[model samples]
Target: MKKIFFTLLFFGCCFLISAQTEPKVGDELIIEAQDGPTYHHIKFPKLNILVKRGKVANYKSVHGNVVIIDDVITDKDNNTYVVLKKKDGSKFFGYLTKVKANYEKSIASGEMVVKS
Candidate 1:
């Protein structure tokens, strides 16, 4: 029983790691939104964008080998914006509006200004 459990756990961990999408910096992706249906040309590994009622499907574009591990994004006064920082050191601020197919609508408003 112990051997079987260990083997299953190992395989499960391997499968999870393999299933992860490897996106590099400077890669551009054409993302199709599911609900509220908005098309966006997203550049990665730019910033981690939380799409409204949409799942991210990776598109084809340029690939870069540069790996960015720094997630710190601060302004002139040193204020952190989002969880993931803009990879290009640019600023972004807008109100994100989302509408679900089940007729459930949601909106998020905030301000973010990235500093050089």
Candidate 2:
């Protein structure tokens, strides 16, 4: 009984950990570019480009890269803006477009498919 309990517990933990999704604000993430102008460009140490939600911007990491759903805050006129702050303390803003995820190859040989 004890052996069976322990085995089930271990597998349960593994399943939960694997199911947890990544990609959060302030997390060092690596996303592969599926399709875009900046395809194959490894954007390292990528941070959240858009501060607010519902915007579009480029998001990259050493292990992964992609142009993800950006939630950038916009003005009253609904013009979106992005703040790209580099590690060197330099900052800039630019317009971005929302792109569909084409391909996502994980750093660990797994795949993620996100559909709206």
RMSD of each: 14.5, 12.4
lDDT of 1 by residue, 1-116 (tens): 99999999999999997554233333222212223223122222222353432424332211221222233234586433223223444332222221111100100111111121
Backbone clash count for every predicted candidate, in the order shown: 1, 10
- In angstroms, the error of model 1 at 66 is 9.6
Model 1 lowest lDDT segment of ten: 101-110
For 24-108, candidate 2 gives per-residue lDDT tens digits of: 3222233434454343322222235454533344443312322343333345864333222222222223332232222222323
Q: Which candidate number would show the highest lDDT if scored against the true structure?
A: 2
Work out how many backbone clashes candidate 2 has: 10
Query: In model 1, what lDDT does residue 72 have?
Result: 29
Error of 2 at 79 (Å): 32
Instruction: Identify the runs in model 2 with alpha carbons over 4 angstroms from their true place.
Output: 22-96, 102-116
TM-score of each: 0.22, 0.29
Residue 90 of model 2 has an lDDT of 23
Computed on alpha carbons, the lDDT of every model, listed in order, comes to: 0.30, 0.36
Clashing pairs in 1: 25-45
